[model samples]
Target: MRWLPVLPAETGEEFSREGQPGDAPAGEGLLSEGACDEHSVRADVEAAAGAGIDRRVYFEVFGCQMNKLDAELMLGVLNENGYQLTDHPSSAGVILYNTCAIREQAENRFFSKLGHLKKLKGERPDLVIGVLGCGAQNHQHDIFRRYPHVGIVCGPGEFLRLPQLIDEARSQGQVAALDLDTPVRFERKENLGPRPRHAFVSVMRGCDMACTYCVVPRTRGPEVSRPVNEIIEEATVLAASGVKEITLLGQTVNSYGKRLAPGRRIGLQHVLYGLNQIDGLERIHFITSHPRFMNPDLIEAIGSLEKVCEYLHLPVQSGSDTVLRRMLRSYTMDHYRKVIDQCREQVPGIALATDLIVGFCGETDEEFAETVKLVEEVRFNGAYIFKYSERPGTSAAADLQDDVPEEVKRERNQVLLGIQKRISLEANSESIGQETEVLVESLSKKDKTRWSGRNRKHQIVVFPSQGDEDLVGDLVTVKVTEVTPVVLVGERPGKGS
Candidate 1:
């Protein structure tokens, strides 16, 4: 398996809160996308260290990395405030639901889940439920008005006030709050659960990207990065507690610090460089870099930092500049090409992944062909090709017409996916018969005899343990013997041919 920089040890922690780790609100987070030395890192240490409130708390996360990291910190906040955690929603004193709103479909699912909770409240009238994260921020009173059972609503920034909100929720059955409006960089909460070998450290919150089709700016407020010192300290603590990998999260990570004036800022590249120095940190990674923010220094850091993985998930939502202009992406196709060229030059064997929308509002066949051409040229390792789904309150929803027919959109999506399948097959085939360093993550879901991990390029690798009981969490070299569209099959070095 690849390396995860084994951490010292810590207590347990939650997965993420609904408010995005990015600057976006909860409902607007779907657009993106641990265990550790379990027990050795005991869970909930952060709770024991802070405020001392110990009521039962639970979290249900939706959306992407930002939300997950929010959930992680929320646990510390709840524990410090004296809220204990319980897995069952029926038994909890106060139920917290972290929400996401990236696409129409994910939002639809959010409501469906909310419907399930309505019946629970009927059974136990005192069982208070609060909606937090993106959903609370995006549709604040709607959740409360639509479902009276949802007693409290708060955005990510408002999580600190949850204890008081719960008390207030008891009387009105609705408490609306959000932490998004203030200057960010609050104190890091203590560990709430056992430390995993990996962790998510949020560096920034919100977005200023007025992308025509996005709700981030409206729901999440504006871009605000955490001070560098706080980030470094939190990461150091994670390293000391046995976190082997740390993923720095933000809305558009590359744009970090641009919103803040000079002397008060350190960019994402600087953060990556800073975190590289932390003891026990074996690997570092960051996400959602905008094309406009892809700087040379960040490119060079990726190539130079051995601990940094060679995987870049750059989103080129559409290939046509006309469509991009309408979408307010702020970078052209040629500019993206230059960034990709720089990435390949800097990080050898870099896995290039991206996001693409197949059928956006008013997208033409010709424009889509341009996107196809772009895909052929880039030959991405993987592409999240999606059909445009309108989101209420977004700029595009107000200004643009939903012109593409559903079937035509579907056809275009299939064509793009076909192109991606070809590219993915070719990209994966290149690794065959070649040896790659892998980090074992988990046992295969389909077969326990096999182990599942990923390479530095972020490609999934599944291989047999080869009877070396000492296989999990260790870095080992393996030769790619087979390939699939999504996974790479390999055999350990020195194992039978």
Candidate 2:
């Protein structure tokens, strides 16, 4: 839940979108002139640590897996710079909220939380409050004006300047580090918080596709893929440190290595091949793929690779071609079906998941019915169904009318959820009596006696632990016995009747 920010690059002058020196806003002071020294910021933080000041930071992250990885990396940097993470915001010297601007619900939740923090800030005047990620990038200086208690506002790209921004915000009145021009790197030497059995490795950042209702391209900037060598090295380090599974994080993960040189342009398939060679890694996964980029090579890699799990989370926002055109999703229903058909053909029994936005600008009931029909035909393992919420600055919000009534949107959302629920239940029922491999993650939250893990298909399988042995990272064979729409109840192979 806690997150960290990036260290600022050593640059005395701030640059505008045009890459020219820009004047700081009058009231906002924007990190003070010439205060972007990374070394000085580190020294100040180190001195603060030496002085026994509370370097505890309470970080609450909102949004997707990419944001989670961002938080992890920033936490590593903060940890390196003499900051400690605390769960309790009141006890911490700093409180940071890594926000999401994608959904209206997420934004509302953040503002509500920020409102609650006003009393806390009033009590502790020195409590350095910061906002990071998409919301920070989208709102920027406006956040400071609205929430005067906020000392720092950093975008996703400018995380490298986090430590420096925090230091500057403490010394100066207010500081803003909103720069989306620079490519955000995902390398960190140290691991923050607990060293879990699984981790997320961000292979790429941002998105090139301009979906009308989405805010990723605006919030995260353009797509930038990390070098193959760098990704392999990061995964290697993670495997060596006891990580068994790693989900490659990106906006559109399948489009990795598109911008790299011809010699180094190996794409995501090659990245999988490299990770498959790592000694300790048990499983590999990537998420939120684009249907357009689900090429044959990537599909072959998923089928062929030993470590790569057989699961795909491809989001088909809508089923209607007209809606798809308006949404600017590029691919049509037929193309999406073809992609799914190819995936199933290549990797038999591959569990498939997707994202669905029920109501968009001018979605019709007939279009909604087509989505329901697609769900019935595909029968995905799971689907993240959401009602469309207009995002400001997006093309849909600017150009199109949010004509779909809220009641209609809600009805359509429930309809899809119902269909997917039945499909999921049926799929899980089919798995009963079959043996599957599960990487034990932790003890079940509801039942202390049982252990929980995910199979290669990314299905949640729970089995009773042989209390004598620890199975946190071990791959155990489980015989599926019972199932629900969302979970699978299984037991150790021979033990299950």
Candidate 3:
């Protein structure tokens, strides 16, 4: 097992003292006053080993579905090594946070929760705390300095080394495996024990695009596509274990095979073709596609594949060419429109979703208006709108001035959100009285009598449970009875229609 060199421990002191008098604010200081004393650390580990310490881990995931899959794989590894999972942090002997560094808000929320864990760590000195994923890669040793109680810091690429890192942290102090240079490997085991109906399979890692307002390149490194055979084999295992649907994950998913070797340079369409052949898998989906790579071959595959859903999540940061140039998106408004036109032409009634960032650096009123016009023209089935948050280590933060005032950014965000809400409501309203196939996922959080699932277009459909029949994982026909901006309320077709 590979381990990063441990940070030298302070001599002759307990490892629990987190902060000292007149130290820099909560997350800035070096090693705490009494942390990582070699003899004491060994004693703690030996004592815990002698007592047969509880191996319950509380794992919390943040950010995208990609992070969730990483946590799932890591948990599977831990389970193989005699560790069990727990929902409550207070009851667990180990706590892991799989964090994201996509937006500033996510980072802030993670720090707030990490602060809360300080009290928990103080109470249980033997408890092991770990920080994983993108945030760990971005913050590295700085996380250890800020929160000395953090036992391990492993990046996304180094997740397979987590068990070894945890043991090292217990014996030494503050072990980090933040090596983004290494390629990420996915295990073929079934990891989604809780959600067996659906799973996320990461087909590729990292991004080669130099979008100015993004941090993915810095956190995840350059593009590296997993071999096509590996993905197929993983999906096959998932299907055999009762996963009905699989969503391929990547930073730029549609650009999967661009970095592979020439002989094995099969694109996402080829992978989708292979997965579609799996007997037990019912649905196939890929997310967060880039316009530059959504080639005709992929579009044709989506239209023709029996298992691929008629849904696309293509993010267009801005609709103005000037803003696109500034953001280094490498696509123009006209080019994006052409791609949308192609999808609509190829697959009729396709549900479209997008991500839009408002009030980017130096965004003029006219540019914002162009974005509004594009939204009106496109009328996406769903949209996720956000005010652009300047991320450190990106070109926008280093060079471009965040000239858009906070209130203006907020106003632009609201304007786009209101437009999308109206459009979404109208789109869903049209679905009323239409019968669609839904893959039941689970019981509704609002009411136990109802079950929640998604249609082929990726629209949420909620229907009542009939008698004692367990509808989970079943594809049932639901007649749309009512509609909201976000969900479609429905019932079994014969009973309601």
Candidate 4:
């Protein structure tokens, strides 16, 4: 039940739009940054091994599940280097803001939290306030310009330099953001915590899409997929560590490896084949896919790999081709419907979720109706609906017009959501009285007696615990006794499959 900030549409406008395809900045920024400056990671690894640095460091995480996993990875890197993690931001010597920049609202929230860190620093002047991840990458110069107290601005690629960055930030009061394309794959990075049933493995950094409503290609830089061998190695490590489920992370996950050697590159298919070979891995899932690049081979992998979960989240943005064309989504309604048909054929009973935008510039009532009609045809299990907002310095902001009235946008959003509610309820009703396996995440905060987890289709299931003294991270089976549009209330049926 932890709150994940799905920023208000006004804040995330640019991120939802469309951008140029097959456009990648080819260059040497890949893997250029080393472990340590003036010194090498080998020497620091030795010294860090021998040093008695605190193993317990307090960590603060902000933004998406990807950032949460990055926090996990950063913790892994530090723990491997003999650093401990602490929960309190005030007591810890290192205070890191695991950041996000996909939306202005998130950036504002991070700075609001940073205000607290600065106050803590006022009490202890030597405290290290370091920022990392997408927000750091997106607003590197701007962040420093406003907050001189920030000691370090490390991007998503700079976690490998944690030991070094911490050292310099402690001494010099500043660390440069790792320039975009600096390859610092924590790919082989260890997981410091206990082997959970579910884990996240980031497969790519940055995205090239300029969806007029998105800031990713700029914030995280061009599309860069991790090497397949590296991903398998990491998956093997996770397998050894007891991770049963893995979700491949990326802005456009299906577009994995398209940038790596161009036409000769091994894509997500090769990557999936490698993962299916790993021992002890149970279920796999990936997300935030662009409908344009999720190729047939990747679809085949989802069908062929039993360990791969039976859920797919391909964000359609808008169902109307006119709206999509304006958004520059590049794919047509017929094309998306075809992909849906193809996927349903391959993975029978696979549940589908999507990100939807209701109101965009020049959208008419007919266009809106087209979106609603398409949603009904797709019968999506879930859909995240959004309205458009003008972002600063984007193509949409420059060339296009934001002609839709706010009231009209709200009405369209409500109509779309109203339709989705019925579809989701129907979808959930279809599962009533059926038993399914779920990965138990935690007890529902609303009622501690009810445990919650997601099924293979990514449907949220809440079941009565029966006072069996269960803990989080255990896989269990529950029978769907009742349902809502979004939640499935059930009871423990037996052990997992």
Flag regions of model 2 displaced more than 4 Å: 1-53, 193-195, 262-265, 495-497
lDDT of 2 by residue, 1-497 (tens): 21332221111112111100100000001111110111111111122333233578777766555666677778777777888766567667888887777656557768878878889889988889999998889888578889999999999998877789889998995898878887676888744422266777888888898888877788888888899899999999978888888888777889888768776556799899999999999899886688888899999999999789888878787889999999898898999999999999999888887767777888998888888888899888776666777787788889999898888887787778778778888998999989999888667766767887778887777888764777777889999899977678888966643
Question: Alpha carbon lDDT of residue 382, candidate 1?
Answer: 75
| TM-score for candidate 1, residues paired by index | 0.86
Q: Return the lDDT, model 1, position 231.
A: 84
Error of 4 at 143 (Å): 1.5
Which RMSD values do the candidates have, in order?
A: 6.5, 10.3, 11.2, 8.4
- The C-alpha stretches of model 4 lying farther than 4 A from their native spots are 1-57, 192-195, 259-265, 494-497
In order, what lDDT does every prediction score?
0.68, 0.73, 0.74, 0.67
Clashing pairs in 3: none
**Per-residue alpha-carbon lDDT of candidate 1 for residues 238-320, written as tens digits (9 for 90 to 100):** 78877777777777888887745676555777778888898898878777778899989889989998888888878788999
lDDT at 190, model 3 = 66
lDDT of 4 by residue, 1-497 (tens): 11122111112111122111112110000111100001001001112233233333555555554666666677667766777554455446676777755444445666877776666777777777788886787677777787877888998777667878888888897887667767756564455332246667888877777777665566667778888888899899988877777878777788888757767967887878888888888778885577888778889899989888888877787778888888877899999999999999999998887777766889899988888888889998776665666554556778799888989988887788688788888888988989988777666646666776677887777777665676566777788988877777777765321
* lDDT of model 1, residue 21: 22
Tens digits of per-residue lDDT, candidate 3, 148-190, equal: 8899999888988888888888888778888888766676466
In candidate 1, stretches whose alpha carbon ends up further than 4 angstroms from where it belongs are 1-54, 185-195, 259-265, 466-471, 495-497
Clash counts for all predictions: 63, 8, 0, 24
